[model samples]
Each structure stands twice: as structure tokens, then as C-alpha cells.
Target chain A: MTPNERLSINQATIKYAPLREALRVTADAGITSIGLWRDSVEAASLPEAARLLADSGLRFSSLCRGGFFTVPEGRARRAAMDDNRRAIEETAQLAAAGAAGSAAVLVMVAGGIPQGSKDLAGARAMVQDALGELAADAQAAGVTLALEPLHPMYASDRAVISTLKQALDLASPFSSSVVGVVVDTFHVWWDPELFEQVARAGAEGRIASYQVCDWKTPLAADVLLSRHYPGDGVIDFAAITHAVKAAGYAGDIEVELFNQDIWDTPSADAIARTIEGFEANVALHLGSLSGDARP
Target chain B: MTPNERLSINQATIKYAPLREALRVTADAGITSIGLWRDSVEAASLPEAARLLADSGLRFSSLCRGGFFTVPEGRARRAAMDDNRRAIEETAQLAAAGAAGSAAVLVMVAGGIPQGSKDLAGARAMVQDALGELAADAQAAGVTLALEPLHPMYASDRAVISTLKQALDLASPFSSSVVGVVVDTFHVWWDPELFEQVARAGAEGRIASYQVCDWKTPLAADVLLSRHYPGDGVIDFAAITHAVKAAGYAGDIEVELFNQDIWDTPSADAIARTIEGFEANVALHLGSLSGDARP
Candidate 1:
């Protein structure tokens, strides 16, 4: 199958796998693209990781992330900025190695409320400022920065931008291709305005990427679940994809899972199952619909 | 303090307490209202339960719940309907026993996905149909049917009405006084349209209840933290309360905590600490604000 659409693997699902092993496993799964994270890519080093993906003809869909700008001054914020700069440079290197795109999207997980600040709005401003700086670097490198809106559980500690509208608003000053929102079903399926927001993202050409997962119950009331899997829970994937497609997005559809159960499985097996699940969950939706009916 | 506002203690917070202890402890807390489960009230018998609330001068702000209307067959649906009727009768008994104006708000926790059914839309329709029947009964008894939209996580197996807008839309055919949304901050805080919805609820006089609690994080992937104290987490209570007040909701601000931590504590201690936390959080926010801005 010379698949016209692209399938990107978020490395977190097989987080336990070595970077090279993960690339090999993902490649074997027939997923065309892979999203890389700082820690994992750094562990493998950019040149070595690039060489491996090059040898395998794998695509770097996007960089895992670059943002945590809500620290209260001093070292952490500066360190985060420096780290983000490095992420851009790394994305540039990955792009140089034949990833087949003018710019890879630099996904930004906006930071949360700063310590001692009940002012969430203020922290949001800090994210915007950080993004402004990163956008300049990203623009220079011909890379896009995708701001991901996490679930509300992470609003205070992980991301202040917790909705598509919120992310779009923050990225308004930038060109759609320079900065945009990642429509992750795991984070946004519960949103009442999800359809409208997805439409908005599409209209503005702000849909940076799309991720799919289901939300299950008996959720631990303490930590946010990164443990979502497609079809294991209840997310209206068919409905969301239809909306996203209606909005004119022609980008890669990425599957990013954060489940302990999936990770416990062997990387090869996990990768294989995930690819199967993705094809079943996403492809079936696409396949069932006529091309004209997608939107 | 001749408290004019309605203050209901949801039984789940004191789930460990014998129904009797919950009543007496709630009374001692100086809160006038209590929300009881049908099972608890039925177990205690209507007369004895009435006497318990009467002796303590406690009121029934609402029946713990009655609408799990998404069952597939005649048997389960009929059983749920009958159970709701019994809840209404028990609520009338409480009203007759000097708990005047303390009529029940039938809190509906919509049932989850039917085993072997992917029809969320169908389940939601079933809930609406059930509400049509229950609303008539509740109206006749002078009780309000409060459609408490569970968080989206519960949309499948709990209440499919996962948003204030959807709940309000369902209740539109009924009088606003008879059908309303339970404004639970824990469930609705992350909603980008919260303020707008609250205004709509208040405009229609459909704010049947206002439940408060923090949205604690680091939640385990599968379980929602039902038990949370107000002002203890990321939710912006000060903002929500301000919107509720501005919407003209002159009702009791009920403290509904589902945390196991609170339940394991002595009922008296839990009640005492909750009251203190409620007051302190309000005061902290109040003092932090400028001018005569009221939240």
C-alpha cells in the first residue's frame, strides 16, 4: 500500500524501548513518521538517531516538545528556554536528514501555574512570551510550533493552555503554519465545544497535528492519565476525524499513548499492536466514509 | 447564624457514616441540608429517616440521585423509575417534617454505556425520555429535577448529558424551576464556556444546585477523584462563584466532597474541617480582590 496519508508514532508508547529499537520497531510497524522527544533523542544523540531513521527511511513527523515556561524565575525558566532552543536545533538536524518536510512541527506543551501564583492568566502570558521567542527560532529553522492543550487535570502543573480555543488564541499572532494546536482526543474529547473548536482550528489552518485515544473510567483521582488507548475507552473518533477533515487538514495523523499496560508489553509486540489498533481505529473510520463524506 | 442559604451535605462524603450519623453530624455542622441516597433512605425506612432529619432539623437539599435511565430493557428501566418515585415520596416526607422549602432536587447521574452497546447517543436519548417522565412526577411533588452532568469521563456509563448546555437543552421544554443543572465546579471548571453557561443557568433560574470542590490532580489513569475539598486544587472557585452570583443565584453553596480521606475521618471532624476550608478559601479569595467585587 502506497499510503497517501501519513501515520506518525509518538515514541512515548514504547518509552521503555531504546531510541534505535523504537525506530526499528515503529518502522517495522509500517508507520511512516515518528515523533521524537528531547530526553529520548538526547539519549540516542541527534546524529546517531538521525542516521538510524535515515537508514530506515523513517520520517520525523514532529519533535516531541519544547515548552515548560511557567517556572517562577531564576534557573528553571532560563534552563527551559535554553532547552527549547536545543529542541529547535535538533529538529533542524532531523529535517536535514531527509524527513521530507520544509519544517517539522515543534510541539509545545505549555507550562502551568507558577508556584505561589494563583494567577493562571499570568502564567498563560508567560507561555505566550516564551512562545514568541521560540517562534522566532522555529521560523528561522522553517519549523512549526504546535501548542498542545492538555486535559484540565494538568492545567495547574503541566499546561495552562487547556483548550483548543485557548491555544489558538495564544498562537493568533503567528502564522498558522508557524504555530497551531494539536487536537488530541485524550485531552479534548470531553470538551463540549470540541467540534466547534476543531472547526475553528481547521478554519484558521491552526490544526498542527491530531492524536487519538479513548478515556476510560475508574480513573485514579490523583494523577492525569497519559494511559489512553484507542477503542479501549469512549472517544467519538469517527465524529472528530470527520470534523478535522472537514476543516481541510491534510497533515499526518499521530497516535500517542501513555499507558502503563501498553508499555509493560514487549516493544515489538506493543508497536505491532499499536499499529494494528491505529489502522483499525483510524483507517476504518476513513475507509467507511466515501471521500466526499469525510468532511 | 439563621443561615438563609441552603447547605446540603452529600452523603457520599460521609459514606462511611450510618445514615443516622450523617444526619446528626450534618446538623451539628450548622448546615441545614443533606443529600441522601435512595438505598440509604430505603434501608433506614422512610418514617425513621424522616424522624432522623426532623430531630436534627436537617433538610433534604436533594435526593442523592434517581436517574440512571440508560438501561436497555423494561425490567431495569422500570425498576429505576419505581425507585425514583419512592425517592420522591421520601422527599415529600422530609418536606412535611418541617423541612419546608427543603424539597428534593432529583440529581441524575446518567448511567454508562450499556454493556455491548456503542450507542452513547441512544443512551442519552433514553435519559431524556426518562427525564420527561420523572420531571412530571417531580413537578407534581414540588421537587426539582436537577440534571447533574457528570464529567465527560462519565458520559458513557453515567450521564450522557456532559455539559450545562446539553443539560439545559434537555430541560428547555420544562420550566426552568423544575429542570436545572447542578453547577458542580469540579465537573465544569475546565469548560472554557463555564461563565457563559452559568449565566445562562442563572438567567433561566435553572441553577438547581451549586456544588463546590477542588479538582485534585496526578489522578490515576482510570479513576476520577470523587472526593476533593474546595480550594485545595487547581479550580478557580473565586471566579466561578463570582459568575454564579452575577447570574443571580441566591442559593446555598453546598459542599460536596467525595474524597476517601474525608470519609475516613470522623464525621464531626470532617464537617468541621470542611466548613473551615470553605470559609478560608472564600475569605482568601475575597480578601485578595479589590473594591466591592462580590464572588
Candidate 2:
């Protein structure tokens, strides 16, 4: 595979760079695929961001996020759904010029339990309600809502969907063509059932995005920013990446690091190391497809 | 249910205080049961600590913990297993004078992946091997090994077993009377299959310990010390406590907070809030327990 065929740098890994600069640096790195974040798309006018990606000759792999459906109603919940709908529209515009990229996959990071509420079940139900409200619209816009189950550490404060099984369960009501799940190494490498779940996800044809990032030891005080590039931590990426590949996943793998220390580095340097780490710790596993990872 | 009948303070909750002082504070606060830690018992001299609990009339709920079987090697592995046997001996001595506490329940925290390794499956296998080595001895010494599945966030550096299902699976090969699993609210509260697992554990007669500790939002810098008292966090304690009750788990609920902020506070005040939180968030579910809850 060409570098562009397999590697995509998620904008969050070089968050300090402006949308145009991020796209430019990623493209300049000889990587021809990129993932955009909703914030970055909005920061530049959506039309201009679309024009930039169109002109840069990069396949827009996926969008960073569009789900925070964990707030209670009145305005906050409505506002969040409305924002997500708008994100879907933005994703549609960017993918209009799709090449090998079929369409922009909009990742959904389900928000945590609502504030002043401990009803985890209620919060999860709300996520489903929001998805039901938006699923048809997503199909209309040609944007797939990819549910991303974050680490359980983020369960209370970020996403209640803390496993691939839960994400698929939530997505089961919708057609796989419109809704799917993300298989990100950072969120799921610790799972004892990782191989089975990956295979299950593959069989269901519901893997919408494949994201890679390493979990750094001595985690940052703000654990959100503790993710390093692939090889920097203890995750056995060759095993996880191989699991995804064995599961019939042939899509672009996005490198989405969230380290504050890495963010402080120049975007060029960061993107360079991301590519290096991906090649060394992650991409090496892409060569073979039939091997089953051990439990 | 009487306050003393269901509630017990784990020594690690007030780890700042001496073992004798923690027990004194517990007894002074009208609590008649407590869980001891190996460090606390060692600090006070095991015989003296046992004498204190026996004299104070506090029913020992369970021992704090005794499992770090992830270390690799002949001497290192043997050393860890030996230490665990000694812990069983200590537990047996403390429980000889029992009132509603037939045998000492030892909470086993299977250690994380060993240094220079990323083999999670191997670490878990090693844990099973160690349990096999100790199960007979634990049974002989009148000790029940309770495997605690910590939150997934602790999977890399603290424990490899990160789910109730995995813990139950590991304990399956052994007799329930010799091995069991801990249902810690702080750890397993985020799981999607929590209720199902709780019921499975109960049906299998493996709910050895029901631990109560809240997962504090905006977790402390040291993730280890981020546990709050019951009502102080977002976990729906009523839901979890009720599930454990419905699952036929009749066991002492140990409050095992590890917050640094609370640790800095006077032990008496911490113990007071624990009881208050227990009554408010956790014990309300205890009112209709079908006469189930052991000391």
C-alpha cells in the first residue's frame, strides 16, 4: 500500500496547528489521507475547509467527533443534537469530492452520565434517543455516525459507551450502512475479548473507523492528554492492528494522539514521529491477514 | 438493618491512621465490623492487631488484599505465592474468633503486566497458576480468596484482570468456597453487563466481597487516590447496591475510599461521612434485603 493508502494523521495529534496548516503539514509529510475534527472544520469556514481538503489532494478519512449527547433537556441536550446535525452536514460537504474515500465517517463519542445525575442507564438511553433522532438525517447527508467507545476511565465524565460490544449493541438498531463502531487501540487494547469483538464487528460490517494511539505510562495529570504516538507506550499494537486486519478491515488507520507534551512540539515534528511510530509499532502487523491473535 | 450489621471500614480508606487508631475510630463511631490491610496488620504486629480486633468486638469483614502474582520468575513468583500463604495464615488467626464471619476473605488484586512486557494474556495466565498453587492452602487455612477486578484504567500498571466476567472466568476452575470475586462499585460500576455479572457471580456463589467506593469526577492527579465516599460521587449507589442485594449476595459492604484529600482529614470525620454516605446512597437499598446480609 502507498503511504496515503494506509496512513492518516488525525488533526487532534497536531491540534496546535490551524486547520489549513494541519492539512498542509499532514500532506507535506507524504501522507495523503487525513482526519478532520469538528472544531477545526468550524474554525475555518466549512466551505473553505472543504475547498482546502479538495485542493490539497488528500482523502479525508474521518471526522474527529460529533457526539456529546449526555446532557439533560431544555436547551443543552437540544443544542448538542443540533450541533451534531450541523456536523453531519459539514461532513457531507467535505466528502463531496471523495476519491478512494467513499465518504467522511463522523465519529460519535457518546457523552458521560449527565451532571447532577447518576442514572447511567438513563444517560445511555439518551444516547440511543439522539441517535434515532439523527440516523436518517445521517443517511440523507451520506455521513456514517461511527460510535467510539472510550476508555472506562472516561465512562462517568465522557462516554458511557465504554466497550466495542456496547457500541455495537447501540448501533444494532440502525443499518450498518448508516451507523457503525470505531476500533481504536487506545480505547480497546486492554479488552480480554478484543479479538472476538473485533471479529464480531468485522462480521457485522460495522467498523467505521480504525484509530491508533499508545497509552503512556505515568499518565498525564489530565489523562485526556496522556496519549502518545503508537510505539511510546506498552500497548501491543502489532497484535491489535493485526486483529483488525484479520477481521477484514482494509480502511485507513488514523493516528490520533492527545498528548499535551506532544502538542507543544512543532506539528511537522509531531507528524513525522506519528508516521515513524505507525510504521514501526503499528504498520508492521499489516503484512499478514490470516493469523488469529491470542486471548 | 442495623448500621453495624452491614457496614465496615476498609483500613486503606483511612490509610493515614495507625491500624489501632483506625480500629479505635471505627469502634468509636459505632461500627462493629472492619477490613484489615496487610500493611496495617504488619505495622501493629499481627498478633497484637488480631488481639485488638478480638478485644474490640469488631467482626473482620475481609482482609485488605494479597495478590501480586504478575511478577515473572522462579524466585519472584515463588516469593509472591509464599507471601500470599502467610497472609492466609494471618487471616485464619483473625477469624478464629468469629461472629457471623466464618472464614477470612482475602481480596486478591492481580498485578498488572510485568516490566518489559505487554502480554496481558500471559499475565492473566500466571494469575491462574498462582491461584492454583494457593487455592488448596487458602482452603486449608480457612481463607477465601476474593479476586477484585479493578477498573480498566488500572489495567496496564495495576491489574490485568479488568472485568467481572474475566475475574469470574478465572475463579471458575476453583471451588467457590476457596475462590470468589469482588464486586467493587468503584471498579465495575461502568460495565454494561454489571447486573448480569452480579447475578452470575451470585449464582456461582462467588460474591465474596461487596465493596463501596465512589469514582470521583475530575479524578485526582494520582488516579489511585481518586476514590470518594459513596454519596460524594456520580455512581448510582442505589442501583448497584440493589443489584448486589437482588443477586442474593449477603455480605458486608466495605467502604474503601483512597482519596488523598480525605486521607488528610481526621480519620473520625472521614469515618463519619462514610457512615452518612452509606446510609444515604448505599443503605437505603438495604432496607428490603429479604433477610440477606452477613456480618
Q: Write the residue-wise lDDT of candidate 2 on B6-103 in tens digits.
A: 89889888888887798789988988888888888898888898888888788898886799899886898888989999999888887775355534
Residue-by-residue lDDT tens digits, candidate 2, A135-192 = 9899998789999999999999999999999999999999997899999999998988
Which 10-residue window in model 1 chain B sums to the lowest lDDT?
B286-295
After superposition of all CA atoms, the RMSD between model 1 and the true structure is: 3.2
TM-score of each: 0.90, 0.97
Best by lDDT: 2
Candidate that scores best on TM-score = 2
Candidate 2: C-alpha lDDT: 0.87
* Candidate lDDT values, in order: 0.75, 0.87
Supply DockQ values for each candidate.
0.35, 0.59
Candidate 1 lDDT over B1-295, as tens digits, reads: 3323345677877878888888888887677778777778778887888788778777677677777788876888899899878776776676666376575577767777777665666677787888788877878887777888776656655667777887888888898767787999878776656778888988899998888877755553444545477767777777777777777765556777777677778998887777776776543443322332322
